[model samples]
Target chain A: MSLESVVAQSHVIVCCGSGGVGKTTTAAVIALHAALQGRKTVVVTIDPARRLADALGLDGLTNEPAQIPGLPEGSGEMWAMMLDTKATFDGLVRRYAADSNQTEQILENSFYRNISTSLSGTQEYMASEKLYELAIESDYDLVVVDTPPTRNALDFLEAPRRLAKFLDHRIYKVLMLPTRGIVKAVNVAAQTLLRSISKVVGTEVIADAIAFFGAFEGMEQGFKERAAEVDSLLSQPDTAFILIASPHADTMAEAQFFAARLRELKITVRALIINRMQPSFGDNHSPEDLAERYAGTPLGEQYQCLAEAQHLARGEQKHLLGLAQELAPAPVVQVPVQAFEVSNMATLQMLGQAMFDTDVTSEP
Target chain B: MDPKQFLTTSGVIIVAGKGGVGKTAVSAALAMASSSVGLRTLIVEVEGKSGLASLFNSAQFSYSEIQLVEPSLGVGEVRARTVLPEDALLDYLKDHGLKRISGRLVSTGALDVVATAVPGISDILVLGKIKQLERSREFDLIIVDAPAAGHAITFLRSASGLEDAVKVGPINSQAKDVLALLNDPTRCRVLLVTSPEETPVNELIETAYSLEDEVGVSLGPVVVNGVLPELPGLQANPLEAAAQAGVELQPSEAQNLADAALFRLQRTALQRAQLDRMAQELPLPQLLLPYVFTSELGPDGLAQLSNGLLAKIRDLPDPSRS
Candidate 1:
């Protein structure tokens, strides 16, 4: 099946690859294509560059879904949002807190303030949370996500499970105990752990962490349960992981690694979109053919540059061909290295058309 | 600036940029440029994914340094190793004489807790290690291939963020020292790399502003990587050129070459426009790295880039001893 078919069937499209692989633009392009096909779509991006917003014809994106302007009038609609990790974490806090006071207690805690915004997996967890929210609550037929630019591919995939485990941690349970109730005999294992951490990070930081977990007592269950939901939703059959990769060896290795990781999670890459591939032009006459055809022409002088260019293209394809074969059954869509990037609606739409019009096939 | 001037004056040059912008490759090339001039260089890889070891075909370097690219004729040397947060924290504990606690921190899974519960601990640990390296005066130049742009901001600001969070303790004092190293222009400078594209240039500008305003780190010349090389006579008709050279081309051959030429011309124009915008927007001296037209930037491609870097650095004005 082509990417168009994947877009038609999948409810959640997770665009993931290494950073600077044009993951955001590819996500936006897929979402736009979905919308044009009369499927109401929402694209949730994490910290989009200004040009992505410009391509979507918006001043900028926000935490809340803002309808994208200037799409061709159609039955389907398009909305875009940039995930604010802290805001999403705060919303989760508010949703789970027993009352306003408890909410304030948890939110005001210094440790919560630090981890909600700066904790390694906070963005990934919140992005997944937002995706679940849009998938179930919103009326959109499809929800496409632009994962955070995390170098570790495992971070986005592991965030929900990691959070759930954190909520269920023995250290967390030990920290949740009242400050006055920490007797010597109580939680000897956890006490020893805390003593070790305190020596290195200082006891004041531990006290803050204890207070942080103390305030988060009643809300842990909600968070753990929600994280569980996200973990399952991610592996659902209707969810597609569209991997966007460039032709370089590094990014190709990254994409291959990503695909292998997804396989471990039982999620196959729905479509492998190889972006910015230099076409070999071997589809036309070979340089040998050209040389033979025009032995005495001025074009013979130009063979060096053209042949060099062709060699470069062949090198790119060599890497991509391996990626395509490994990610079998996923439609391999090759978007040629364009003369221009997607800057405006016209070009964006042009890209959307080009995505499907190009070679969208799968040998597997 | 001469290659010597550029290599010797800089203490720790942190090469950072958005992912896929050839930041790692730039870091490797910078190390090559230094070692070529008989400068002992150490390239510190953070997060452990920069592919630094692969460029040299060396084995994966751990927390400790290993000889990566051996010098030719005893003139140059490049050693590389990784500095991760967890490993740095472990070393940090040992350095502070908490060797006993270090073992428990790992066995009890408290390392993750300490790193996560206390904000900026992870980053500070890594920076503190870098600070230690600088203090050792081990290398003529220390090139830290820092994280991509978004995390690069947090990474640089982590010391200040820690100082704000913890007013007293070893962590706070450690942050103070790291901040000292970061703020001192002579000690450390951030060399930002970016492609000649809209998004990368945009991210680099914002990261530069944050590094200056929030982190107070000195900025070096912005490296415009992947700049398209211009070719003469790109606009001329391929058929006419072919005819002029006393050879004729089939229509299809002419068409294929024409299409490739047009794409090249347009890419050059677009790159030139973006490069101009960058000069006006970010008022910093820029060193342009030509786009290597190879498939993979292996040792050969990196050699070319390394040579180009030295040539560009020489054209720059010598740094004043501030």
Candidate 2:
């Protein structure tokens, strides 16, 4: 498939792999290629390496969409944002709330803000909702996302369902412990637990939780509905997931495991980009020939280093082939190891070239 | 360095310290040495830095157990990869080549990425992988180039996060197995690496207490990198002379001599003060690495570091013996 073909067809490109495998860089390159092809693209990176800025030659960026410079002004625009987990969570709460008053109450309530933003996996839910909004709005022709490195990276893909389940659950209403009159003997289990917690902690923290739940009482379904909408948008044909990995066994295993999970989940596995790949000079020199030629040679030391490097490269290539065999056998691109580290856009463009500039169909 | 002493009951050795304190370099050196001695070793990190890769001169590495070097050594760099529920099912099927007949099952929600993108998710997976590596016994040593001080506790504490999320199931069972390995003192140890700077020193001390209090991981040795050695036999005399000469010295040859002496005095004083502070704060034994100013810490440099620091560590009697 040509770069244009993938860009034109794939709607959602999800980059995943082991950390330090250049997932963020790969995402930026694909997005940039899409934009250059006259498709509006937005790249959202969850990588803290902040290499996305380097890929775009941007010094820094905020959570909001910032237009990348140096691309032709009118042809296509590439907008990038580093995912700010907390701010995104806050934004989601505000955006999905029924009205300004409810939004204000949720925002002002410490318990709501803490559980919504600081609680583990909250950011993942927000990121899911945010992407769903962008995908549905059709503001960009394509959206490229960089996922957090976690075993849950696969589970993260299931976040909308989990969030929706929690939103739809009756636990919050039960936790509210609505005060009943003296005539009716209501279930005081929640009230007793709240008082017990206060006694143990010497504070009325449970009161804060109750207040937060009260504000969120009526609008929980709104959140659940958005979660449902997102759940549907993710599996659409327009969406494609790119599995990024390095030429390491552990990374390949992760890619394979992720690919397997994707198969199980039914996400479109579009293509695999093996980042920071080592180049194989090929097996033109047999081991016996290499040994005999270097036996009495004056360049023995240099030969040894070259032979060792060649050996390492071959090992990496073997591992990459194994991953390909394990996956869907789509277009596999290998980005050769650069002499210099990727710290700026020039290098990233070279990386993009390594990824997108290849003869598209040559499977690794 | 004595490999025997190093591998005594091989478990997990997490190297943590302030950012840029040579923790990565030290972890790589230790892992390399461990592997050289016929021990299966794995090094892990959260940030996708190929700090260890550059040392080994390898370009591609992974998050699962892939050997970057020959024989017994491996490295896993855990970067998050999202598989939407539907897509995950499809990926599973496609690996089985099920995409040919049934491809409609893929879930397209962005929720997977959104939910897993939380701050501690990376930390949780990172530590979980490290814990997994530690348990395999495929490697005698599991060296973790842990995140900087601020997040080290959370990285280790991610076990709790996973446990909370998975109340019951195979994932919960896996979490239990990993947590068992983590809590075993013989199976794991946390090594704090620090420089002789104020911020890193304070952070190291704070991290030590937090990890102990929050995660219950015992703090190991504090490896102080880039430590300046004292000028032998050139101590109080020069400093006293400088202090006595309150009258500013003129720009002369003697002034340069006095200035060099004063520089040595100041550095020695600073080094002593740093060691003293660490002594008061941390109960663990401290290891010191001499300053090497060059930017690159390649293979040869790493070997040299392993030899030098391990030699110093060997020379010191174990506090247990004392």
Candidate 3:
């Protein structure tokens, strides 16, 4: 019902939207608001844009929590970190391995490193794992996450299950099966095929892969089960998924898709923050008059340009208003796009206030 | 254009970088440039952002490409990935007579199960479509206003990966065609757009190396947009520093002092330092664009940016000419 209410109950707050729509800023603002309300908060961002650090006034931050400066200096603190997907994956393997030797074997494997860094769903898995770790650590009352601009935005939703399945698949079990003795014709045939493949590829990468999988024999089910639990934690109602989008048709469409997906996954989308929205002045004569006056001059041409922007702003506002009307169950907050970028904390706070206006959704 | 010089078999020019770094803007510009040279070009935007629509001042551009600059350039917004997902590809396939039977195949845990079981199934479909567009003989170049850096790298790499995973059928052959286009340096050029920011710079460098190593596609160059102009008279020297200290600055000299102070020399210096770091870290030559303080980038403004780009292009030997 209220921003505070959601903050108090929600363990995981996932930010979803198209790129350049200020989803990261919304996540940071929500995290800041929670911390300000006497709840320990950590905003974890996977956006490659690095906007959270800028919004929080940090030069840069690593994967671990870095305490932010000048946050009113109180009992409830705010910390931020950028998710380094590769590092997190490496850390997980290192932690879960049977021994240091096993860990080294996996790390040195080409397949593992490639899958950890460049794979599509890997970041989403890492993000979920990171959130699960944060939830387990209980250092913070809430963890706000900014997801990467994915194709379906479902990867964030599907990540835990996907990883769990990948770890627990029959292929995984087959790969991990120890080859203590190989008297069978099938083993000999496979070995010959592997040798031919190695010669063609100019590397023994397959052998390296098999060795890495061998080290994970006893640890497979543990990782899979952990992934399943993490997935449950994410889909629970306590983990609020906040959908952020602009007022543009494209952004609104994205919001719709995300909303439907969230509904399917049974994740409660408690609120929607429409960022960079154009505020409606209600019967403003400035745009028309200005456009007419500057009709001939370059400044007039400039006004012509501003006219579309003004119109789009008005349209977006109307669209958001329509969305709020359509999705009446969920509270939608509209933060008008400023003339300049929302780069500073002062501006972010202002936006937070605009977005969480008490008048919009009265607290229960 | 010399075919021998063309590094790529298909000219699939993908414009990608960090959001707000003007990837769409550069994509439109590159499309216009290619089309103006009499090469038929189609610029496809998957997210339906319609940044290209706004640039072209069109009311609406749909899945059906609308001609922007008659006989040459065109732009269109396909179904945004979020809305359709695999359905977008399904629609494309259905239009090509692949049919609902195929959809049923994908859903029944038979075709779908097999596809899903394959390591890079989605990559095959998503990239197979884009690669098909690239290979279309109707256009000389297909400019894709791709997703931002994180996803774009994965999208580009999908071609070769699918080729390896689907090593035997028509899909594998299609993957080979796409891979040939992508791996050929001349036919396909990957342009990265950035605004002289640290994160974008670092990401761009990371993307360049990743593409080079993983996919064998050389990153063209870094297009540094929104660079500040050097105002000679307003330059901060020892004289200006002394003036700021209140000794050299008088009422008569106040204009220059205020001017120097207000122009954000410190921020500009820091931005330049970041740019310098980019030049050092990235092997690709950088194209620096002058910053426009104006609210909107209209046609004239875009033309100015394009002119600056053209001059930069002239300095480098045209691969086609070479």
Candidate 4:
């Protein structure tokens, strides 16, 4: 199916790509198109561009989706939300906690307070958790996700599994026992492990950790089950993944890697959207010929400009051909580099038109 | 300080930026520029996937330092190595002569525990290794290719955060030493990298302020990579300009030429506007590297970029004067 169909029909669309490749912009454009097609849509971004936030009329930090003002006429409705990782983590704690006291225990624990934000997997995992919350709990027709900008974008997919692994680790189990005051189960090896860790990080860290784990008790099953549900939700027919990329070799490489990884995970990339591609000059003539034809004149310099621009465009096309070959049969949409930054709603609409090869933006 | 002093002023120059902004490439250029001035430079790569080794025409760097550029007449050497928390922890254990515990630590997966249980332990481990390298003075300059901007803030601040979190232990002392090195301008400084684009420029301003107000890391010149070069005769119409130049162009040719000309002109204008805003919002010396349009993005491209960076570095005003 076409990318427009993905926007029209899918319940969830995940935009995965590296940073500085306009991944967030692509997500926004897609969401805008979905709204223009009269489908209720919400685009969630980890860090919203200041201008985008302004255009959305978002005054400050918002925990829920806010309706986008002044969408092109006939657009169903568009909403934007800024993902607050900390607030989402706290929500999980409240959801899984057996009682509010358990919830307070986890929230008030200094170690949890410190690691909940800085935790290696927490940021990525929290993004998925938020996605699950919006997809399963919200009423929007489509949920567009701009995945967090991690060096390895696959971290978002593997994060739940990694956290689950940590939860089930024997060492983690050992740490939990001490908080429960199970002296009988603390083997000599476990004792040595605790002492060794304390020698390196001091006893207070160990104490804080035990307390945090104790507070986390009875919450693991709920988290594990939710993770399983999210995992299933991702691979379901209702969900779609679009891989965003650029002409730069580094980004192209990242895109290829992401596609391959998704394949390993049994997820198919619906479409490949390459943003910021140089507009082709369509000059088939060689630079040698152009120079001879327009030598020693102002026109020669102008022709040189054309030649240089064409050279870059040709090179990018070559690189993208390899990407296309690697990702064979996946429809590739090439969007020219924007003349201005996509900081406003007008430019965003123009980009959406360019992606779909349509001119519905004529009214503006 | 002059360019040489601007570079040698601090033993450690941590290069960081948003991913896909050529953070790793900037790190390579800085190393090449430093070595050009007869300074022995070593680059510490934290992201094993950084492809920094390839920039120097070498294989992937492991824990063992690989000499990428050998010393020559009037030029120093360039060497690099990758530092993971696992390797650094093993080295730390071996340094203290606890070799047996080291093997068991890995075998029992206690290292992962240490990293998870102690927030920022991995970053501190990596930074601690850089500290050790700085103390040895084996290299006149050390450039760390730090993580991307988002993680970079947390990475650089890890030591200080841990210092406050853990008050008395080996981890605490390590945190203190790393924080000291970061805070001392003469010992280390951070160089924020960015492209002349809106989102990156905005992020750079925020990152620069965060590093100063939060991490207390000394800031150096902002290396603005990927600046588009000014196209000649941008204002003149291609058809009109050709007619004036005593040359006639076909309609299609003129169209293609105008398309390219407009593209280049708009890009250069945007570059200027973004740089102007950056100057107003964040007043740091800017080192402009032209946007690369090369088909060959290997050693040759890296050399060209390095030369441009070195030229810009030489033009920076003396910090003491500021």
Each model's lDDT: 0.83, 0.61, 0.63, 0.81
lDDT of 2 by residue, B1-322 (tens): 3544655444878888754567778887677666656666666655543356666776644543455666633432222112122332233334433344332222322122222322243345445556655556656677777765555676678666667754664335545766776677788888888877554676778788888877777666788886755544333242333334332323342233344344445655766777899899788778788754233466776777766566666766654666
Candidates, DockQ: 0.49, 0.03, 0.08, 0.56
C-alpha positional error of residue A29 in candidate 2 after TM-score superposition, expressed in Å: 0.8
lDDT of 3 at B189: 75
Which portions of model 1 miss their true places by more than 4 Å?
Answer: A175-189, A192-196, A282-305, A359-364, B72-74, B318-322
TM-score of 3: 0.65
Of the true interface contacts, each candidate retains a share of: 0.44, 0.00, 0.03, 0.52
Real A-B contacts recovered, model 2: 0.00
lDDT of 3 at B132: 62
Colliding residue pairs in candidate 4 = none
- Estimate, for each residue in B34-80, the C-alpha lDDT of model 3 and write its tens digit: 55455666777755444667667665555555667666234222211
Worst 10 residues of 3 chain B by lDDT: B75-84
The better candidate by DockQ, 1 or 3, is 1
Best by lDDT: 1
lDDT at A208, model 2: 54
Ranking by lDDT: 1, 4, 3, 2
Residue A207, model 1: Cα distance from true site in angstroms: 1.5
Best by TM-score: 1
- lDDT for residue A354 in candidate 3, whole number 0-100: 70
